[model samples]
Target: LVTIVAVNQTGGDIPLSQLYAPNSKIPASGSANLTDYNRVEEILGDTSDLGRGATLEYHPDPNLLVAKTKDAPSATLDCSVGVVAGGTSDIPIAEEARIIAAESGLDVVRAYDVGVAGLHRLFPPLKEMILRDVDLLIVVAGMEGALPSVVKGLIDVPVIGVPTSVGYGYRGGESALIAMLNSCVPGLLVTNIDNGFGAAAAAYAICSRMMKKREE
Candidate 1:
């Protein structure tokens, strides 16, 4: 149900243009370029006898249609910020974080439910943010609260840690909050338990300050 039109970019004869005829890797014979031949028309001609559809439609190459390019913005008025969460329980936290971060003109990039137990899923998004030179990072973790510390150690950016109430117990999130506050990571900022919005606000403030300094 689809018709494909391809121009020979190799400066050679159309590879499979002649359907009924033998196909060859022949060189461009004359000055008649690949554009001079209509592949879609040739294909339609072969199936013309089976005629059901009355309309003939022509579509240009999609890449050509989308050829417009853009330059990166000159100012950090809308600064880039990264938000990551350790497990599925922290997804709502990440969303809250995203909303708060946006209030401070930060464009939030989320990596939700990146499993800390596996560690492999965690690294790629973190590596990407490092490559992008993100203004700040917000890490949300529940249970033992180890993920934020791990993330803080790996990246050069300032990290704000949010401890969520994911586990079951009398203490529950309190334990995670205590763990995060007492983290060995030298410069990690810890928020109260289940306080993703606070963590995001903290990161946003840092980013806003950095952006202002750049303007100065």
Candidate 2:
């Protein structure tokens, strides 16, 4: 299994043990670090994944870790991922997903500034993705987060919605998250706010399964 680490903003172990009781959500995201040998060791003695055949990789951005097994997906696999950014501000997150998916051996293509305000701009790149037969679409959008649902309506493939912290008002990206969660589209999947990493990881899993089916 590949493991991804979400580093603490300040760069150290998250205070999960200290804050877990008060904030239930923190544990869900932070507790996974328990397997990180350098940080936590009590739970798993040989927590160093290298010995267990797990490899480690880091994101170009400092706050995240990625697992890239270059040989996992064969070069011949037909699966690819399409990434779309609803606006310029969303590109960094989209890039994160693209980099992770590419490193994990999935062919990745992109479309940018295709927000719903300019619906016409979305079609060309989308057409390219469809022509390439992309296995999944990672749509990163903010401000109402309608792009994912819109793209899902247009394409038959599954969509992964990444809500970024780009809007105003109550809690960070919660509005977008709510909008995505409320989508009527059946195959649209929603990741957490600013979680491009999660979206990529999910895309990798799907592509890996596709590759496996092809081999069989």
Output the number of the lDDT-best candidate.
Answer: 2
lDDT of 2 at 201: 73
Which portions of model 1 show Cα errors greater than 4 Å?
1-78
Q: Please provide TM-scores, in order, for all candidate models, with all chains considered together.
A: 0.62, 0.68
Which residue pairs show backbone clashes in model 2? none
Residue 2 local lDDT, model 2: 23
**lDDT by residue for model 2 (58-91), tens:** 3433233332222322222367899999998888
For model 1, how does the per-residue alpha-carbon lDDT over 25-45 read when each residue is reduced to its tens digit?
Answer: 112221111111234455335
Kindly give the stretch of ten consecutive residues in candidate 1 with the minimal lDDT sum. Answer: 62-71
Superposing all C-alpha atoms, what RMSD in Å does each candidate have to the true structure?
Answer: 19.1, 9.7
